[model samples]
Target: MSIFEYAPAPESRDIVDIKPSYGLFVNGEWTDGKGEAFKTINPATEETLAEVACATDADVDAAVAAARAAYDKVWGPMPGRERAKYLYRIARIIQERGRELAVLESLDNGKPIRESRDVDIPLVAAHFFYYAGWADKLGYAGLGPNPRPLGVAGQVIPWNFPLLMLAWKIAPALACGNTVVLKPAETTPLTALLFAEICRQADLPPGVVNILTGAGETGAALVNHPDVNKVAFTGSTEVGRRIAESVAGTRKKLTLELGGKAANIVFDDAAIDQAVEGVVNGIFFNQGHVCCAGSRLLLQESVAEDFLARLRRRMGTLRVGDPLDKNTDVGAINSAEQLERIRALSEIGEAEGGERYTAPCELPERGFWFAPTIFTGVSQSHRIAREEIFGPVLSVLTFRTPEEAVAKANNTPYGLSAGVWTEKGSRILWMADRLRAGVVWANTFNKFDPTSPFGGYKESGYGREGGRHGLEAYLDV
Candidate 1:
């Protein structure tokens, strides 16, 4: 749960050790890059945490070459059981150093300390443990008698959930025996660098997992590189389109997990308080940085009033402030650019005829923060209802029947995820079948497990990221 009620107890940042500047991790070694660097700030206080190196095109070439060498000689030829040993070691190391990773994640990514501690870091370790069990058992995974690695994988992840996204992309690739050349988002590169340290702690072979830090140009170089065999990206739909075009005629196995404007349908029969909590957590989690966030609330006309009243009350109870505070339900926005995007979209939400109701909260003066916001009297055609806001904003629309609810929910081009709240099991099943999303959660929101496959269709991008399906992206079937 993103929203919490507790006394103020801050997680100490002293556990983390950040260098003044960081370099690229190629061949399990560090390179200072071409001396071009950018500062990654603590979004809570707008304090410059450290200077991160910007990887050049040649840096991408070196990383890819190292990954290829590892795949060709060391990592690929290693026995599956031996690879499993490394994964298990990495997972254990993550659990041991969980506090340090959690603190650095909150400092770098602007999520609350409790969330970074409880939710993301645990999930990151879980992904590794789950995939480790599948390492030596690929033959029985229902793919084929034998499935081979895809060689060098070029992975680019967004800044929303840094360590968790790394786990989602890297763990599966390594389990399937594919070496990776990963490029973490520029805004949040610290955890990925630390993860490179974890690989060293596990005694993972040189060049088996290389991390190159930079912005979009570095990502483009990796995506369009000649020797890279697979491309996996989790970011905006526009960038996903560009990656798809660049690899259109190439042999690179591509997978993209992009944006979403998910709909949360709440019927009159759904428990009001329960549905209220679900709705609030749906959009406000991770400052709405999630790609499958339930931003659109489709309510039954008969219960829309009561549901909305409870939702407003729930929103009022939320505490918004510093990322390090235990009491702050919503933390700082991820970055200044993301803050501007949220503000611009919220303004458009007001202009497009949606009645706005912002939760009362005293935001911190130094950092980027957006209070919990709701829009009632919203039309399906409004820009607020149709677009992905990626902030702490909710758009509510009323519908007469299940058919109308499904119709409104399925109207978006994104088919990443959706939510349904109803007491009737048959109705839940019916709605789940027609929601047109990759994941449909009933009675719960923002719940994830490593065993379940997660991805989207159409503009949300294709190919799954967890379970057995995730293995396909890094393997040759």
Candidate 2:
């Protein structure tokens, strides 16, 4: 053990006052759900955070009916500038209460405070800000002279980045003059509920945004609701597939942002030091719970040994512990079930003869935790390399040439995102051209901007979110 140990510097939990219980936000008020309530716990300490109401089928219907009514009576008839003002107010309120939201998000979602504060919350505000400006500019967006809003958008967001995903789904829908009935993930509903409060603070019209909290059943109810004219989802590929099938043959406009096993390719001629950082960010950022996380690393064989040595050294310096700590790097796994899934896949990797290397960090004993892990001898056939682990695990494979790198990178069924690190601009452009991913990072990895449109191709799901393209999802083009 090292003699110089850093003391814990935890952020004050008093910054956020979590309520004992939360209710569904429907038609501008908190109301009891038709189903039993569920408890959400902090995955970092296994501490119960709050009890949240779970929406039942009737609750979903009521929420949808509210949204449809708002769309037809208030939101739909309102001028675009008025709608823009509400969105701008919401964005400003998000910025004002950012610290509270960030801390609450870390507690509820078990992500590092660094991420919740700097990345998630800020981006949440930015998404609203970005789309807020577009509220009145739909005509010049190249869609048509007059692009009309679709009625009542039903949005289902996953738990990985709860508030951010909600912003991604809700911002564009509202900007296009559509009302929203959003169902947040069961495990991470607090932030969305808090966002409901933000909606209230903005004086957003009643029923413009309704938040439903529940498991998959509630999401199904919202998605299949007859009054909903649009559906947007961000979650596992399996769920996305099911949603696609369920909404098939219907006239509902749909956009699904699904799973990814993205590739971060490093060439021998690249800046190895910068590339190493990019690789770490690609796989381990957010505890590798990102939908477009670069879980697969493709390295040129010539520099594999050197790169691995540097990567291992850097991984050793990561701090894994309480999410509220200001200095913590990696945080707890989102839940026990997710941790078990990660462990099972990692065991499969070891059994298949892949060499496993985990970051040397002490995890808290109380809650769900998994160390940062990497499989060096991974092959294309290995289950860890093929499936979406959705945890802090990386599967490394080597390639001899650029062609082979692209081949291995594009081999997977997912094509949500990809990254390439090289000094040669021509090679970067060449690689980007051939890669089928929706977002390709040339030198950086996992950098997101609200101005950039994000989504996937192939089995990774279809349609785009963010930028002007996001408007098309909720508008009659």
- Candidate 2, 1-477: lDDT as tens digits: 342477988888998999999999999999998899999999998999999999999999888889989999999999989999999999999999999999999998899998999999999999999998999999999999999998999999998999999999899999999999999899999999999999999999999999999999999998998788999999999999999999999999889999999999999999999999999899888999998999999999999999999999989988899999988889989999999999999999999999999998887889999999999988899999999999999999999999999999999999999999999999999999999999999999999889999999988999999988888999998
Which 10-residue span in candidate 1 carries the lowest summed lDDT?
1-10
Off by over 4 Å in 2: 1-4
- Local distance difference test, candidate 2: 0.93
- lDDT against the true structure, per candidate, is 0.93, 0.93
TM-score of 1: 0.98
Tens-place lDDT per residue, model 1, 267-322, is: 98998899888988899998999899999999998998888877877887888887
TM-score of 2: 0.99
